[model samples]
Target chain A: MTAIPVQPIVSMRRVEKIYRQGDSVVHAVDQVDIDIFPGEFTVLSGPSGSGKTTILNLTGALDNVTRGDIHVEGRKLQDMSRTETSRFRRDRVGFVFQAYNLIPVLTAFENAELILSIQGVPRTERSARVRDLFHAVGLDGLEHRRPSAMSGGQQQRVAIVRAIVTNPAIVLADEPTANVDSRTAATILDIMERLNREMGNTFLFSSHDPQVIARAHRVISMQDGRVVGDERRDGNS
Target chain B: MLILMAFRNLWRNTRRTAITLFSIGFGLMLSLIFTGIGDSGYGRLIEGASRMGMGHVALIPRGYLDTPSIDKRFDVPSDLIGRIQVMSRVTAVRERITGQAMVATANDSAGAAFMAIDPGTETPETLYFMDFLESGALFDPKNRIGIVIGRNMADRLRVDIGGKVVYTLTDVQGEIISGLARVSGIFRTGVLQVDNYFVLLPIDTLRDLIGYTSREVTHLAVFLEDHAASRSIRSRIQACVDEIPGAEAVTWRDAMPDIAGLIAMDQSSNYLFQLIIFLLISAGILNTILMSVLERKREFGILLAVGISPLRLFSLIMLEAGWLCIFGLIAGLLLTAPVYGYLHSTGIDLTAMFTEKPDVGGVLFDPTIHADLRPISLAVILTVAAALILLSGIYPAWKASRVMPVEAIQSA
Candidate 1:
């Protein structure tokens, strides 16, 4: 008999992360169970404080679970040290945020080089990867431009390039299109989708935007720190 | 690349960068200025005092400097001066007799400390006394009654060169000896102390006039090749003196405790000023770094949101501050060269501003300032400035890295 696969790329088994605020405990992520497969585009949607971002953070290994096991690629989050978590983030996860946190002092190419540089990639290879990512994000000639000089849409595109430049196992995008116009948001979604299909990479995001939700292969609805609905789409690829 | 980025950022925020630079620049300038003034003035004072008849190093009868009594005189051997002259480090050695006396002429009388020297064995500074000849020649040792009067003493006595001056003093036997000497030379040394109360006479004549039977001497004045080698040379001389009976050696610093104390006090004051300047620069740098980091809270949160570790973010802030420090150093160093050069050549004269003069141990104070580009001072300043700037970034960077991405995004 063939052995069954045991764990997903990112899986949280009844995970809960609570924070203490003065006198009361906040259920940032309460009894949340999640499994994100390889090569899948998933979206977690909710209102403010609904624990969508917390779940994404836990799945990305940016935060440790308070109660339950959070495993990424068969490695338990509880067992990982701070350095190991940082390595996991460095080599196993990528992130795109709504604020497009590209280093303002660094140019588009330099910002993208952050992850690659820290991973000890050679300068030649890092430069090539940065140029390719900038081209892929439709910012081919803007590699030398700083984030401050670029428009909101252009900066967001550079942020996407920075997130994916390391070619990690999973990309976590938290409201990546919130800062851009509808047209630019569509293009950003299309690039992410194309990258997902072409590179066979996994992408997971948390957003309340309808456009972001419509583009996902799977949608997980969250309310009050718990998943309310899980829906999968089989077609429209 | 971080350096380049930091430079651009500093230029972009020119006003803020200028404030930070000024903080560092003013600190550098203050240290240079005060230290320059002190170094220049003290150096002049020491050199002036040493050259005014006394050499860089001196040898005196052991207990005579502490309590000068005729009984404490040392009978230096006739061959000892010749032996010291052969030593390579010995520039010049002259025997001298020093005593306190009341000198009088027909019109006036003044109390003074008299230094009697062999005019033939004179150094250039001997000219500070004998060169301003009003009439007759300076004292010749063959003539026991020839004396050179200082200009101020001459004026007080209502006498000039060729006039006769009367001197009465109690001899070593406690008997009063009265005599008259012809004023052979009249001179004006620039120094106030020497011009007012000093009277130069031939050593042999003074000895005979004091009625000493043996070749007993008050002190042996020594000048060295290198002033800094005084301690070692003094020790060597002391060793030699130890081999011989009834001899002692003393360095100029030991010979003059008050002068040494004056230099120590100036050095301590400079150290205190340096510490205050360092603290001021540190506070300024801390304020700038803290403000910069606090302003970029949302930016740092976004960086963490995109998987940049908090440690790396912290390093980035430190690197930025380090780069700023380098800029400040470069600017400060560049500005130092011309200012130091100008001040070194033409010292800031404060004589016009202050009518009341300060004296450092008997030496009059002057404001002529100078600074040398010492490697040690430069290294110390650079290290301190950089450290202050780096230390200023820690708390702000930590606070920045802790910014929550979710909250930052929501707020944005």
Candidate 2:
């Protein structure tokens, strides 16, 4: 008997991105093609200036691709208007920034529930879901604390919980553990790995951290705006 | 949640919000105070003129305004007087006869305005003469030929109280008439024209001297209970005048167009001054809001990345500006209330500020200026404040909405 191929959740075909500064044109992302399957804990690894963050930005629809088609859940991103793209991101994708960019004025619970609020979820359901997620992320008692009052690791955990509280199709985290200590980074990785395993939540990360790269189920390595190595690992190893 | 965010955002920088509030509050306070003082000053000017025998309404002969000759006299309608006297709000109606004449003492001569009034019927308050008398009575019922002269006129003519003077004018038959009259009283109203040129006589004596019959007079001055009710009262008097031939009722504002124009100019200039103040306030608020929006570019980028549309972001910025303006308006009103109350009650005395009281439309003004609070004026000011705040918010909010998440997050 022949095995059926699993359909990818996000597909990129010959994606290219170029930037113009003054009179010079530079290729920030070359014709790179890749597919990310559902429930895959993937990492895009590259040195500085190797287009890892650029690819993350493109995949999340934070920017437009110069020449190529990118689809999320089989919906073409290039065909959407600016407003439509925003709505698509709001409903379908979540993001975690390297800086843990929580709103300074909002408390931890508010920051974590912001995506759910933006999605127009009811107050009661949002409260319940955010509370459960906060407990799961080990930030149970710090719900009312603002970002400035929290440590770097705690802020990132809030960001992580915020990213998944809306039940998005995928989460794109850019250097999620870059600002934390080794112990905190390991904790963050453990939490994200558990969510991926238990809830079938897909996560794509851009990082240069060796620890983050070592835990990924699939690691796509890039050099000079092009993917040089694509490695896939089976369960745990 | 958006409102909560906006309100929290405003206080994130306490000093900036305070300064913005102070600026708005100060501007509104100045506008209120200036409006109050200006209205009070203009109100006094109008009142002074109205009390100086212009009254609230006047019934004049058809051609007397165009030519002040003795031939322009109209016969006084007794029934018309009875009808007007019975009307509500009508305080007094007095007969008057005015003509240009020349008066001479033994040593000097000057041109004078002769005003013939019925002392028996004319109220002293209506003429505003009882309080301003320097030496003698307004008019004595026993003295038919008694004349009242202003202090300045007395000085110019070199005449004293109880002195005899000769007045000469052309009568209705085009014949020259002369009369000898005794000065019974002298007044100093501080109005240059009235003090220098006015001469009052008994209406009956002037009618006889000018060859007028028993019921002939040049005009009828109508006084009202409240000067502000002049427009409605004038309409009623106008209807009565229409029933009588060769009579027309005119309000004080219509009788003195130049003074009315002056008051209008004063109001318009006050509005212009307030506009200038509001412009300055608007600029300050605009600067503060724009700076805040610029500083929050990265935050706006994060908000956008979380799927807040550009329009929503714009609304958030505007909401912040609205909160700032509301705080400012409240602070301003709170700070101004007590000061306004004190000024309204005690008034600002200009007696020490000026050597001579200001005069307009042949009437002397009181030196003390009291603040006037009218509901319409307050409404206008509040509306202007609201508009200025909204106008100041537009550019900053638009700029915030236009921020691109990619560039904003990546810039720094």
Candidate 3:
């Protein structure tokens, strides 16, 4: 008997995202096909002008596709309306912005639980989830501190907790460790890898740092808006 | 949580929020005060016109307002008078026979407006003119032909207390009738029109001279407890007046258009001034909201990137404006209460503001003005201010909601 085929959590075919600047045209993301399966810690490693973040944005429905088909969790990104895409983003995918964009007015705990709250989760359950994730990330006693009051590593750990608190199907992190020192970045990467390996959380990170790329289960190296190589370094997938 | 965030956002710059709140609170306070002044001023003028024999409302013969003549007279029964007197706002109901006549003494003759009143029914409280007598009494209770003339008319006709005079007019049959009267009182009202032309006499004497019964007077004056009550009572008594053939109930406004029109014009000017202040306050509101939205575009982009709906962001901004409105109104009420109370109780003497007491259409008003803060006026100002704030909030909220998350996040 044939084993049933594994469905990809994210599927992209012939995706093209172009930009027009003054009189010149830019192919920010050229025609490309890629698939990211469940529980795979993948990284799109590229230079500054490469299209790794664009692909991540398209998958999370943060930006619209110029021309192509992208399916996250088997739902077509192009078929979703503005409200539907918002719900899809709300329920299916999470983001870790490079700036650690925690709302300055809210405490760290409040920031971590913000998405679950928006999803109409009960207060008790949200608190329990946020605390559980905070403890897992080694941020046990810093829940009440705001982003401004915490160190870069603590804030990023809180951001990671925020990203996966709802257990979304996928987490898109763009240059997540780009702001801090190398030591802090290593700590953030270690925490993210621990969550991925131990808890089976899928992660798709975009970064050029060799440290981050080395820790991924698979690395998709890109250059000039085109994928140059795809390598799997582990047997997890 | 959204409300808490919105409320907390306002104090990011405490001084700016305080100043904006002050503008709103002060504008609302000024609106309240202006309304109070207009209400009080109009009340005084309307009462003055009502007490000058036009009453708050009157039951007059049809076409009498346009062409008042004894020939067009109608009679109202005693039971109708009693019924009107029992109505909600009616204070006193009295009968009168008014006409235009010529009064002459041995030295000269002058044209005069005659108001024939009943001594048994008219009092100083009912007839404000009776209180301003410079000399003598308000017509004789015993003498049939006793009359009261203004000081100017008395001077013009060369008559005084117990002075002999004669009045001539055309009666209902189109025949000229004459009567001999003694000037028993002289009044000086400081109004040139009234002091120069008015003549007061007893109703029975004019009825006798005109050859008419007690019910056949020109009109029945219906005084009220408050002059503004005429608005409702006139329509209410119209059906009752419709029962009497050829009779109609007329408000003091329709009876005395000169005073009513002037009051209306003054009120319009007051409202226009208040509208300018409200527009300025709205501009301030727009500035406050727009700045707050513009300063937080990146934060909003982050929110949208995460999964907060655009509509929810819009609601958040609107809630911010709503909080401003609520807080501003609280400050306004707290600021205006003591000032309004002082004006209502121990009013400011406006004698310094004017050389003399203000007069409208020959009606003298008080120099010391008081505020009348009607409940409806308060409700209307508050509602209007709240509506203006919400209207001003829409543009900023829309701008914030329409932010492109990618462009915004990348820009910063």
Summarize candidate 2's per-residue lDDT along B1-412 as a digit string, tens digits: 7888899999999998998898899899999888988777776677667666666788887766666677876777769888888899888888878888999999898899888887777566677766678998767776887889999989988898899999998899988888899899999988778889988888888888888998987878888776667898888888877866887788888877777899889889999999999999999999999999999999998888878888888899889988987898898798779879988999878789877767777777778777786667788897789888988999999999999888988867
Assess every candidate by TM-score.
Answer: 0.84, 0.84, 0.92
Which residue pairs in candidate 3 collide? none
Task: Give the best candidate by DockQ.
Answer: 3
Interface RMSD, per-candidate values to 1 decimal: 2.8, 1.0, 1.0
Name every residue pair that clashes in candidate 1. Answer: none
Which ranges in model 1 have alpha carbons more than 4 Å from their true place? A1-6, A21-25, A234-237, B70-96, B102-110, B118-121, B124-146, B162-184, B190-193, B204-253, B266-274, B305-312, B333-342, B348-361, B364-412
In the order shown, the candidates' DockQ scores are 0.42, 0.59, 0.65
- Flag regions of model 3 displaced more than 4 Å: A138-144, A197-199, B104-109, B123-125, B134-146, B154-165, B179-186, B224-229, B346-357
Collision count for each candidate, in order = 0, 0, 0
Quote the lDDT for A202 in model 2: 97
| lDDT of candidate 1 over B210-244, digit per residue (tens) | 77645777777777765556778777777666655
Native contacts recovered by model 2 = 0.61
By DockQ rank, best first, the candidates go 3, 2, 1
Task: Assess the local accuracy of residue A202 in candidate 3 as a C-alpha lDDT between 0 and 100.
Answer: 92
Shift of residue B292 alpha carbon in model 1, Å:
0.9
Question: Which is better, 1 or 2, measured by TM-score?
Answer: 2
Give native contacts recovered, as a fraction, per prediction.
Answer: 0.34, 0.61, 0.57
lDDT of 2 at A33: 95
